[model samples]
Target: MRVLFFSNPLVAHLLPQFPLARALRGQGHTVAFSTAEVMAPWLAPEGFELLLSGPSAEEVTDEVARRTGADILFSPTSQLVGAYFAGARVDLSLDEALAAARYWEPDLILHEHLDFVGPLVAAVLKLPSAAVATDPALEPDVTEALTAAARTRCLERGLELPSRVPSGRWLLDLCPPSLERRGALSPRERIALRPEPHEGPAGPTRARRAPVGDRPRVLVGLPHAAGATAGLGPVLRSLGTLDVDLVATTPGDPGEGPGLEPGRVELLPFTPAAELLENVSAVVHHGGSGSTFAAAARGIPAVVVPGSEAQQRQAEPLAAAGAGLVLPPGRQDPASVTTAVGRLLADPGFTVAAHRVRDEIAAMPSAVQVAEWLVASVSARRGR
Candidate 1:
C-alpha cells in the first residue's frame, strides 16, 4: 500500500512516527513523508522519500511573529502557536502537500497530531488519515486552539477537515499505558504504537561515542525544538559537582562555568540519543518526546528541565512514573539541575522505576503489529 505521512518541520515532531513508518515499510508498504525541506536531512538518512511541503519551523516562527506582532519563542500561547500550526502554516503548506498527495496517490495518510495540513489533505482528497500523537495528551486548550484554527483555515481554503482531527479517525498513541493520560484521545481506535530512537543512516554504529570509563557516565542533551540544545551550559557545568563523567550533544560550545571540572565533560555536535545513552547511567535534557522516550525505552533515568508547556507535558508523565524528575522552566537553576541529577544517580529506586516503565513499553505491541493493524484498517475502509 502507498502510505504518505505529514509532520511539522521539526525532528521532535517527526521522529516519534518513524518506528511505525519503518514497520510499515518492513511489511512491504511504500511510504513517503510530506514535510518541509528542513526535514530532508533527517528523512533522507532514514531512507524515506521526502515530499517537500510546508515552511521550515524557523520560517513558520518568523511568520507567526509577523502575523501576531509577538515573538512566542521562549514563551508561547496556544493561540499564537495554533496560529502557526493551523493558520499560517496551513496557508503555506496546504497547496504543496495537496500536490504531493495527488501525485503519490497514497492509500493512507498519517500525521503528527499537531500538524494541521494533514487533516486538510485527507479532507480534500477524501482519503483516510490517522493522527500520531508524539507526546502524551496535550492540554485541552492546546487541542481546541489547533482544532478551531484548523477549522478556520479550512473554511478560508474551501476545504472540509473534521473538527477534531484524531476523533475523525485513528489515534496512534506512542505513550505507554502506564504514562498515558486517560481520555486524551476520543472514543476512536487508539492503537498502541511503540516509540523507538531514530537510528542513523547506518544504524547505531555510525553514531556511537567513545567508550567511557571509571566513574558513572552521564549523557546530556540540549534540544532547541528538535536537535541538541546549546542553552544548558549552566546545568551542564554544574554536573562537575558529581563524580560522573559526561558526554553531551549540544549545538554550540557549552562553556564551563565555575565548579565544573574541566575535561570531564565531552561535547559534540548532534549525536543520536541511542549512541549517547550507551553505557550512561542517567540523562539530563530539556524535555522533548524524542529524548524522553529514548531514555524511557532504555530504562535510563533522566532529569528533565522543561522550558515550555509542551515540554512540560512530556516531562510530567515520566516524573509521575518515578522514572525521572522534572525541573520546571523557571526553577531549573544550576543548583537545581545539579541536585536533580545527583538525586537520580544516587537513588537506586529511580532506576527500578525506570526499568518498570521500560518493561511496560516493552510489553506494548511492536510497530510491525501496529503497521499490520493500519493496513487492515485501510482495507476494511475500502470494504475489502
Candidate 2:
C-alpha cells in the first residue's frame, strides 16, 4: 500500500502522525509524508519524503510578524478567528502540497482536516482520504456537530461535501481518553493505544538544571503556539525563578516576551517529545493533544492553560480524570500559573490518576492494529 500523508507545516501537527506512518511503513507499506520546507529535515530521518512549499522560515517569520503586529490590538480570540478564516482563503501552499500528493499516487490520503486543502486534493484525485485529527477538539463527534452547522457556511463558498462524512477509519485521538472529556468518543470511534509511543523512543526520568540550580524536573510546552495566545514567556519566567529544571518544547522566539533568557530555559528544538517526557516531574502547557498524551504515557501530572476554545474544550476531561489543572486563557496570569504548577508539583493524587489512565492506554492496541483496520475498510469499500 502507498500512503500519502498531508499535514500543515506546524511541528506539533506533524509529529504525532509520524508514529502511525512509521508503523505502516514497517508493515511494508510505502509511505511519503509531505509538509513545508521548514519541516523537511525534521521528517527526513524518519524515512518520510520531504515536500517544500511557500516561503522559507525567514519569510514565514517575517509574514507572521507583520500580520501579528497589524492585528495585535484585536483580542486574542478575534485575532485567531480572523487568521483561521483568512487561511482558508489563501492557501498558496496547497498547490505545492497537492503536487506532492499526486507524485505519490497514494492508496489513501491521510491529513489534518483543519488544513482545508487535504479534502480538496483528495476529491480532485478521487482518492480515499482519512482525516487524522491532531486535536481532540476535531474528533469525529465534534466534526459531525460542527460540520452540520458548517455545511451552509462551507457551501456558501462553493465547497462540496463528500457524498457522506469522510469515513475516519482511524481517528487518532492522540490525547488520553481521560484528558478529553467532551471530545472522547465511543470505543469503536477511537484507536486503542499503548501507554508508550510504539515507534518513538522512551522518555526521560531526570535532569540537572545549571541556571537555577537543579531541583525537580518540569516539561513546559505550548505546541499550538503559532497562532494561539502568546503567554508562555511570563509563565516560564516565574517558573525559572523557582528551584526546578525548566525544559521548554521549542526554542525561544523574539516576540515571545520575558522569561526566555539564555541558560534559564532548555529548548528541545525539533527533538521528538516522546523521548523528553519520560523523566519529567510534570508538564505546563496549552492543552494540545500531542503534549497531553506524551505526558500521560508516563503518568505525569499537568498544568494546562488553554489559549483557545478548542484548547479549553479539552480542559473538561483533564480536570474530570484528576490528571491536571485547566486555567482559562484570559485568566492565566502569573498567580494562576503558579498555583496550578504548585498543585501538580505538591499533590501525589494527580500522579496516581495519571498512572491509572496510563495503565488503560498501555493496554490499548498499537498503531499497527489501527492501520490494519483502515486497510480492511478501504479494501472492502473498493470491492463493493
TM-score per model over all chains:
0.91, 0.73
Question: Candidate 1 lDDT, tens digit per residue, 197-276?
Answer: 76665766544555556788888776645423434566666787788888877555545433456657777766766677
Q: Write the per-residue lDDT of candidate 2 for residues 1-384, one digit (tens) a residue.
A: 888887766666677677778778888888887666778766776767765655443454445446655442234343333343224222445577667777767888787645445666666677777766566554454445434433444464466653333233455555555655562443335554433342333334334333355466787776534643355566677787666767775654434435555665566544556556655788887777777777777788888887667678776687788988899867788777877888887889999998887876776677788778777877888999
Model 2 residue 115 lDDT?
48
For model 2, the superposed segments whose C-alpha errors exceed 4 Å read 51-100, 138-160, 163-170, 183-215, 222-244, 249-270, 329-331
lDDT of 1 at 247: 83
Residue 349 of candidate 2: its Cα lDDT?
Answer: 95
lDDT of each: 0.81, 0.64
